[model samples]
Target chain A: MKEFLVISGKGGTGKTSITAGFAALAGDIVLADCDVDAANLHMLLEPVTYHTEEFIGSRKATIDPTHCSNCRLCQESCRFNAITSTEIACTVNPLSCEGCGVCSFVCPKGAITMHDHVSGHWFLSDTRYGPLVHARLGIAEENSGKLVAKVREQAQRIAQEKDVEYILVDGPPGTGCPVISSISGVDLALIVTEPTIAGLHDLERVRQLAGHFDVPVMVCINKYDLDEAYTRKIELYCQKQQIELAGRIPFDRNVVSALVRGIPAVAYAAPSTSENSAAKAIGDVWQAVRNRLLA
Target chain B: MLITIASGKGGTGKTTVAVNLALTLKELLPVVLLDCDVEEPNVHLFLQPVVNESEKVMTTVPKIDGNKCDGCGKCSEFCAFNAIAIVKGKPITFPELCHSCRGCTLVCPTGAITETPRQIGLVEKGTWSVIKTAKGTLKIGSPLAPMVVDAVRNTAPLHHGDQAVIIDASPGTSCAVVAAAKDTDFCLLVTEPTPFGLNDLTLAVELAKKLGLPHGVVINRAGLGDHSVYDYCHEADIPILMEIPFDTKYAACYARGGRLVEEFPDLSDRFLKLWDVIQHHAKRHQREEPKT
Candidate 1:
């Protein structure tokens, strides 16, 4: 099976819009949104969840008031400063806690207990296009990268079971742990970037990140007409790096309008619509990706 | 005084506020600017610091001695990050996943586990612009940014009576950001007015609370997104340090490699006054309770 992953260097770079187009165009694929922290792919796919499971990424320490006196050893042991001093109760700061469980081991009062907090939830669902795997990491929860990896693994397993030929994965922005988990073992990576200085700069960073894993990547300029000079610069970068430039879409208001309407630009504004130019440009991008992957 | 500019979301003008503030301070005193966005640091592009010297920084990696090799998966079992995996007879380690905590070597019963050096990235130093603002650039592949931040802090120029050190940190309240603001006296978080911006700014504020770093806010593209950011600041009792409007000309100059202090000469006096306010607040905060 030929798998394709899409990622962007920064937010609002039109990665989801283009990924939605590929989902609408591709057939018989397991679609997934690896950007669990800020996932919006479900807005377009309209995936009807068939399976849902709570994801407990890490353990949290809770003080059992009935257990014993507040010896304060657990509070002293917590490097995260999670334990409250005035309340006389040791509570884990959801954002501060790293799930190290050191407090449990260090508690002399034996009042501290570890509990599995439902950090987030993962979903396996049926979308209009096909089966979709999406997830939502809870507020102030750590281990987003791990949750992303789990969801991707589930998607890959489902794709393998059904003998699906493609897994269109919508990866996260940035070159952090989550992005690394998303791009690993993917056949092709579509790095969507803008035609701006920071756009090109972060593009090179993520591109190098993908290169470290030896993953083949292609470039897609989302707002090419915004800055022709930077777009040409990105093209040169792709050529110099031997990475293919898939295609470019001129800046259009219809793209955002289509998003607010909850539909892929290509389907909502195909060849016969006012957004025909933008839709056709996306078609050309898919054509290039197809020739690069299927050929 | 040490001031750090940070944000939770990217492209929210962390570097812009940082470089501009640093330049504005340069007119007041000797300024040192450290870019802690090691993942994909673009501050250098704006600061354009000339490379005075370069040094390679490395992280501790596990070294397996083949002669002392016992193919036991003890190290793999002890790894919390799933970095160490024993496939068949050979043990494999993913560098990106390793947190360099040396847990594997501690758990390995056999003498096979040893410390080895792995160069994650570089910490290069020079001066930013003609004003000689000290700066650093972290390469892309190097994941050990916190280490570099610590290193920079160790060697960071002091405030020197009247001078102040301003740090431009990476987005997100991760270990890297913590490392960047380790010993900072105060911090200013730059953010736009958006849902993502608010979410991240609140998270960053929580981080500052944990770290006990007195901080304020700098609202970039202030009027574009929403006023909820203002409401959030008021509710949290955090001061709005500075506000840069959604001026297309300013953004265009920033995009075209024009320094804000250079374009808006009036900003220099404003930033100087900002420094005075920060100094007063930091002093008042520190003096709130005298240490016995």
Candidate 2:
């Protein structure tokens, strides 16, 4: 199966929206919503989960106060500064802990113990478009990158089991761990950006990251008319970088309207409905992506 | 006061709100803007801060001493991150996977393991207009954004009672956002009025509540979606601090990195008013928090 990921280094650049559009257009696809922290593609796909697994992505250190000694060794040894001396005993701040197990290992009293942290849950579900593998990381949870990796692995497994041709992934914002997990090893990464300086800046970072992973990339500028000057700048950047420009999608209120209706813009506003709708532009972008992916 | 601008969803104007709020507050106080979104630090683009200082944020990775002669597998077995593994009777380390816990060094029976600093990101400090700005940029392929965020947060004297530090946190309620929200006096959760925005706003609110932060909401693009976001705030007792109406002209201006307060001076009053509400709620919450 060919895995195609839609990512934007910056948030809110229409990664999920565009990925959902691809889901609607692609044949024999397994959708993977790797934006586990703030997953929005499930809202559009209407997934009815058939399988769910609790993801123990990492471990958290906890202190057994009954056997504790006030040596402060765990506090000093901790690189994360997650351990602190409370009035009663030394405590582990769950949020600050990186679950490295050093505190547990170095504790003189053996008071600190490492336990599996139920960081998130991944789901295998049936959607109108196809099968979807998505996840929801617990609130204020760490290890989102691991959860994303789990989702991708499960999606790829399902794709292989069902002989699916394409794995369309909706990635999170930022070039952080989760973005890396989602975009790395993909057959193609379609970076969704906008005609803003912020967009251009973040696009460079994402492009560099894609290059770091040796992942092939194509750029698609959303809201191309918002700033024609910056749009030209982005076009120039693409030209200089030798990256393919898939297409430019116009800013359309209908996209949000479609989102409110819980449907893809292409499905909500068919290409035949209007000559210059965002839906038409999306269809063209998909065709471009498909042609390149199949090539 | 330390105020964090964050959102659960991306592209909801966290940087816009942060930059403009700092610029507006700079007129009345010494304001600092720290962009903690290391993976994609965008505030620097809009602020145009001429960075005068740069510091490398480093984490320790094991440096194996091959001459120590014995390749006991104990270090590999003791590593929690699987960053070290016994390869060809030797311990091989993957620095990217290391959490800098120093566990492997302690577990090495042959005393072959040592620690070395690896740069994961960079912290840049500079000034833009009257605002002191600092930002963190993670090395392209590194995953240690939270570490960089902590470094950026420490670049300024955040404890000055008379100073205002505005932190533009990364989107989503994850580790990076958690690092930015730490020790903040208040959090301004920015969101738009849409299903996706509301869905993620609820998550961001949950994170704020979990952190026990005094937070309020700013509704950007108020006229774009529906009343669900407003209803969520009303139901949750989150004060709606400010509202920037949906205007294409403002959006276009922002696209070119134009400051709202500079392009339209009338908006400064709105941000100032936003500060007023934030001050009122933040102080009230602070006073009540001590008792809890």
| Candidate that would win on TM-score | 2
Going through the candidates in order, what is the number of backbone clashes in each? 1, 1
Q: Provide the TM-score of chain A alone for each candidate, in the order shown.
A: 0.92, 0.97
Model 2 B-chain TM: 0.97
Deviating ranges (above 4 Å) for candidate 1: A10-12, A20-30, A36-144, A158-165, A253-283, B129-145, B157-163, B181-187, B193-219, B222-243, B264-292
| lDDT of candidate 1 over A1-295, digit per residue (tens) | 7779998766457787899988898878899898776576887777788899999887777777766466677667654566764455556565555555556666777776767778789999998888999987764455678888888889889999999989999887677656777887889999998876777888988988888788999999986876777788889988998888899987665665566567887778534465436777888898899898887
Give one digit per residue, the lDDT tens place, for model 1 in B197-236. 6766887787777777788888887666557789999999
- How close to the true structure is residue B207 of candidate 1, measured as C-alpha lDDT? 70
**lDDT (Cα, tens digit) per residue for candidate 2, span A91-207:** 999988888888888888899889998988999999999999999999888888889999999998999999999999999999988988888899999999999989999999999
TM-score of chain A of 2: 0.97
Best by lDDT: 2
